[model samples]
Target chain A: AQTIHQWPVAEIKAVGSPLSLGCTIKGKSSPNLYWYWQATGGTLQQLFYSITVGQVESVVQLNLSASRPKDDQFILSTEKLLLSHSGFYLCAWSLDRNYAEQFFGPGTRLTVL
Target chain B: SQWGEENLQALSIQEGEDVTMNCSYKTYTTVVHWYRQDSGRGPALIILIRSNEREKRSGRLRATLDTSSQSSSLSITAAQCEDTAVYFCATGYGNEKITFGAGTKLTIKP
Candidate 1:
């Protein structure tokens, strides 16, 4: 069994402030990691994906960047936050990329004022 | 429909009734995944149907995929109050990125 953990269950920050969120997966090695953002009642938008350590790919330009510092860890950060950045951030892991089903973490709730 | 340039939809039904959610995509896809999200939680994979499979069933949930029509549908039987959540259909066009639908909010009244 694999478990995914996300830090800072919730955060309230001012616009233009710096922000960082972290996720760690246990019991799975070389898993594909992904970051997603969703508005309160809107669709989920993929932000970034990581296939290996030290390598990350951006799916959309939401002014956000992601880094895979370790095989089991992924970080999502931005230099300056925007009001539109307020939403629920989710971390997901999968065994494969193309057709694998992803397991998501508890998620982090961000409020940019 | 919940996918391709459409807004989110809401459906309310009484408990023990059956409900179906639909999604239509514009691009070509090899797989269609169905997910459900509770309030303030991440989406969980409920069912997945491949182009070759056409249709798949698990317990009380049934998923159908029509590659020719570029659409998919998920049906739940004997809906319970705990089934209230948002359902989304996602497609993978044989790529790393998976496109998700706008989602449908289902409310099961007990």
Candidate 2:
């Protein structure tokens, strides 16, 4: 079985503060990683996706960046957080392709004030 | 019906009632994914229908895909209180990213 874990389950940050969130997947090798953001009671928006280590693709630009530094780890970070950046951040993985069914992690709740 | 940019649709029904949510996409896609999202949690896949197939069923859930009409539908039979959640239909092209609908919020009253 595969398990995905996200760090800092919840956070409250001020505007202009730097932020970093991390996700790690276990029991799967070379799985495709993806990042998604969802507003409270709003629809999900895809942020970034990675097919391999060190090669991340941006699906939408929201002043946030994601990197896969290791095969099992993905990091989402920003230099400055904005009020609109506050939302639920989800990390998902699929087997080798974007079209495959994706499994998501527990997710991180962020609040910007 | 639900799609991109539309307001989130809401549906309320009594327990044991059958309900169906519909979604339409604009662009071409090879697969349609149905996901259920609980409060404060990530969306979980419930059913996936491919362009090659018209309908698929799992347990009490049924999913249908109409490639010609560019739409898909998810039906829940004998709904329970625990079945209350927001349902989203996402279209996935073979070579591109997946596009999610605005979602339908369903409330099952016991």
Candidate 3:
């Protein structure tokens, strides 16, 4: 069984503050990892994706970045947060090379005040 | 931007009733996926309908794809309270990555 874990289910961060959200996967090795952002009342936006360590593809740049330090560890971070940066962040993994079916994490809710 | 900008906005239905949501894509895709997102949660894969198949079923849900029209439809029968969620349609043209639509908010008036 594969499972996804995300840290800090909810957070309140001040604008211009640094942010880091972590995601870890279990029961899988070398899977495709993705980070998506779903703004309030908006659609899910793919921010970044990585097929291997030390390499990530930016789908839609929004001043945030992601890194896959290890096979099961992925981190989403930003040097400074913006008010518009606040939203629900999700981490997903897929065994399918084309990502037909992606398993998602619980997600982290961030509120920038 | 890859999906319909002002299409398939939302849908409303009653319990025990049937409803279908449609999606149209701009690019050629070999696979189409449907995801359900509950409030304050991440989206989950509900079904993956491929281009080679016309329809697929899971429990009480059924999905139909029309490649010629570049569209798809998801149908839910005997819907329950748990069915009230946002439904998103995503496409995988030929690569591992996918692009998602704005999603249709399905409100089941129970």
On DockQ, the leading prediction is 1
Better of 1 and 3 by TM-score: 1
Q: What is the TM-score of chain A alone in each candidate?
A: 0.97, 0.98, 0.97
Question: What C-alpha RMSD separates each model from the true structure?
Answer: 1.5, 1.7, 1.4
Off by over 4 Å in 3: none
Candidate 1 is graded, for docking, as medium
Per-model DockQ against the true two-chain complex: 0.78, 0.73, 0.69
Cα shift from native, residue A9, model 2 (Å): 0.4
Docking class of 3: medium
After the best TM-score superposition of candidate 1, give how far the Cα of residue B90 lies from its true spot, in angstroms. 0.7
Interface RMSD of each: 0.9, 1.3, 1.6
- Per residue, candidate 3 scores C-alpha lDDT tens digits across B67-103 of 9999999999998888999999998654556788888
Interface RMSD of 3: 1.6
> By TM-score, is 1 or 2 better?
1
* Per-candidate local distance difference test: 0.92, 0.91, 0.89
Candidate 2 per-residue C-alpha lDDT over A1-113 given as tens digits, one digit per residue, 9 for 90 to 100:
99999988999999999999999999999999999999988888888989899999998899999999999999999999999999999999999955888898999999999
Worst 10 residues of 3 chain A by lDDT: A94-103
Candidate 3 local lDDT, A11-101, one digit each (tens): 9999999999999999999999999998887888888889898888888779998999999999999999999999999999998377548
Which residue pairs does candidate 2 place in steric collision?
none
The per-residue C-alpha lDDT of model 2 at residue A90 equals 95
What local lDDT score does residue A7 receive in model 1, on the 0 to 100 scale?
90
